[model samples]
Target: MSASCPISRDSESIKKLVDNNIGGVVAKTISITPALVPRPSIAIVDRGLGRFYVLNTVKPGEIRVESTDHLNVRFIYSILNAESWSDISFEHYLEREYPIAIKYCRENNVRFFASIGYKPEELSILGPRVEKIGVDAIEFSTHYIGRDYKPIVDSAKALRESVSIPIFAKISPFTPNISELVRELEKIGVDGIVATNTIGPALSIDVETGLPILGGSYGYGWMSGPALKPLSLAIVAEIARNTKLPVIGVGGIVRGVDVIEYFMVGASAVQLCSIALIEGPGVFKRILSEVEYWLKTHGYSSILDIKGISLKYLKPEPRRTWSTPPVVDEKKCIGCGFCQQVCVYDAVKIDLIGNKRIASIDQTKCYGCGLCTTICPTRAIRFLEQDLFI
Candidate 1:
């Protein structure tokens, strides 16, 4: 019994010594700078909008993902087929499209935005699904083909009030006083406005068969891609000039240059439908890369710097006349005779004996249309500056 008591007392003394030593060491280390301590490699995962996280033991050579909100891309669900209206169940269609869009956004690191079909009542069903999938925003078609905008605006306001997510209203170009409509929407506390949904029941007819392309007035579909760039620019420029709310530019964005143009006109972001449909999703990567390259070349750190650069230069100026039409180099000309055939006014003549085609512009007949320059296969012709008024 005496021997056991000694062992117990010895253990207690040892514990006291260890605690005192540890306390002394901690006190002495208090003056050590944090920078002197080696830290474990941390992986930073960015989920956008000032959100990030640190992960221990990051994989080798992992690239840190940066936020791309400044160059945000929105996916537009343009109803290409009427079956989407009735034949397909709305719930099923939404389910299919939502996953496709969400996956695309996740892979590309861009925001997902969609316009619900133009029915107000359908929002009760569609809105929940969109929000459930973590969609950043939802857009509503505010202007019907021939209907007044009052009902659309009212419905949009109601939806905006009901939904927790941001609401956008896509206004048509045909709407009278579109700027006024945008202002009214802003007053209703809408998150954003998309201007000029589609131009109108655009028509293309086969002259030989004398028939409509889509049959029986397909009613105006949205015009987009290269052809609509100028129109989109004008609409976006107007909205940018007037409104304080964010503007999402759509229509006719085919290349990175187009995207820059839209931003210059005051679009917070740009959306593309037709170009994606025409060129496929791969176009997004090309566009993004080209945009980044252009930004770097122009000494810009971000897209924000170049945005609205053209606003100051928007004032109208007198048009200048070219001094002369383009002249073809006789030595470089291969005598293809393409320019001769393209000239409508017989301004170009091919000298078969000399084996050389000479283009002599008769000032009276020459309209300066530049049709010949376009027909030249070789880069032998260029428009020389001319100061003639047609």
Candidate 2:
């Protein structure tokens, strides 16, 4: 069992001790190596109520991890990182370059996370090795295949036993009961939870070709964009409400405002998968600056001041109430009358307002169902809800 490339002579004795207490009947084995240098470490651990901290020392790995105390974290999947690389180069990347990149993150103090697919053993081998090689944290992202989630639960437990580094499990919104999963993760000793990963065997196709735009054999690729904000936010809010484990919210986070939205729902930190690819890392600084400005202007000391403030408003069910109808902004409106066409209630009428023809919505006739707003091509329709009580 010790034959797989021991890091040092002491590793053999360490393996002997670890073997006595097997972490279940796990398939993979990791050769844990002693850290050459003892450095300051920080872990994004759950401090209850879904809050987290970058603490000075973590006891799990015993050897302090060299990481920044900052709560900000970034994630990249090996599949995404290796998409276009040649096999030899990809192998080299898996063996050395990727670990080197993780080392860079550790040295620079950026929280490092590498997300894995369904396989648990991948974490088992890489977790301790990276801890030894110098990455601070690891994340597990899995999609639930069937009703049975035992494999997912077992994988996390196996990794927990195999490595001492903080494990942040990314919750899939597709799961029937995310709160239940959160509790299971808590029991398995997951250091924290990442509120989401992308959903779907979804497809985006060319109109002319009737084939996927993703440009591969498969017609569908994983779908994620600004469209995912609501779904991801719901998961973050649900997990935050149900469990005390800290959440790293993700999905469709294109702006700093989006980050605040996640934090307000109790995400301790966050990750952006798709937007970072589109806008690049410069977005991080821009977001932090925007959040800082917004918080300071509002008399909050820092971003932390606003975190989870919205949790109180997240109810088990949305309040039942009547909303006001959509209003048309004449300045930006093209006077297409698309909204008027779609208004089933006949609440809209076209009129020559000044020189332009515009759609007018009658508040008395409008039920505030807001269907006309959705069909507006000119985006002239504005949907304003009356005050909560109104």
Candidate 3:
């Protein structure tokens, strides 16, 4: 260092020159304040979205969107679609079908009850195995052959003696004295009674071919669905009036309304078959959903609250005096002779010359079953209830 000559000032001048040169050589970079990025899409999720996405369109604290506890209805899966007494083995069908139904019930938390219809010796094979599944109950199909109550009572007794699980007897509606059968079943310590199997070894005939659909004299089959509700209700009400054992009603149940109807008639629970066959296994979920919706809408907390509620208003009127047979409106009649062909009582006769079918109501023979109303092509027949009219 020869001399110290204001190097600090010179250094400041150099820095200024460098800054000016940089500014002139290139455009000055703008100071970049961090920009606020648009907020990411907020996804509002619901608890029910775990299985399927349930949108939160429904408001919280909304009474219409309230959750309901499921009803305690036992689902019994029958192996056969219709009654077939051919080479069909109930055990074989049970072995193949029961596992599928059991898996479904387990996954859904639904109770499954297996029904065995064979003789005591035949059902004995399944006894040990079924006892291990811890099913709700093992029901013995008592209506396999007919309305004879002796065999059913004996079977129930045998089953109860053999297994620790509860035994239920499924009986037919065609029994002359259903109350007697129920009383006998209760006396023998039966756990429950499933009232009414599908009506008939019913046959249907194709008049043109004069042959049965399933290869028999009578080709017609038992009517199910909405048509059998009234009959089921009557039987359930009758049994409820007489017996103390829990009655499980089965017939023509399609919807939650039908279930409620059966409950009102004093059924502890109701079973569905035709609806399940027509719709599928998923029909059970739909029925439960609708039932829960109905219960909540009606301000009912539990299904027990509505059971037998209709019976209180039910007044018994004299059968002969209050019930009347089908009356055909001649004005609406088309002379198709469908009514004459359908009458089981043979009460309708057609005048070939007049081209008119006349219905004579035989009070002694007409049990007011209303089979005629179903087959009438023209909506001419109407049942007049004397009590309701009064």
Top-TM-score structure, candidate number = 2
Q: Which residue pairs of candidate 2 clash? A: 327-382
> What's the TM-score of every candidate structure?
0.58, 0.65, 0.57
Q: Cα lDDT for residue 180, model 2? A: 84
- Which stretches of candidate 1 lie above 4 Å from their native place? 1-87, 94-108, 143-148, 216-222, 316-390
State each model's CA lDDT, in order. 0.54, 0.56, 0.54
Candidate 3's residue-wise lDDT over 1-54, tens digit each? Answer: 000001101223213222221110000100112112222201111123211111
| Per-residue lDDT of model 1, residues 1-390, tens digit only | 000011112223222222221110000001011112212111111122432221221233332333333564333322221111222344543456445545544444444454464555665556666677666677666435554568667767667756788887766666666677778888888888776555544544345877443333342133334556677788888878778888878776666777888888888877654554445445556667667766876679999997787776666663355435557776545555667778787767665447555555555665567787766655455565444222
Candidate ranking (TM-score, best to worst) = 2, 1, 3
Query: Which order, best to worst by lDDT?
Result: 2, 3, 1
Candidate 3 versus the native: TM-score? Answer: 0.57
Determine which window of 10 residues in candidate 3 has minimal summed lDDT: 23-32
Cα lDDT of model 2 by residue, 83-198, tens digit: 21111222343466445544444444444444443456655765665556544565664444566666668778877887787877755667667788779989989988876655
Candidate 2 global CA lDDT score:
0.56
Question: How does model 1 fare in lDDT?
Answer: 0.54
Model 3: pairs clashing at backbone N, Cα or C within 3 Å:
203-218, 203-219, 203-220, 204-218, 204-219, 204-220
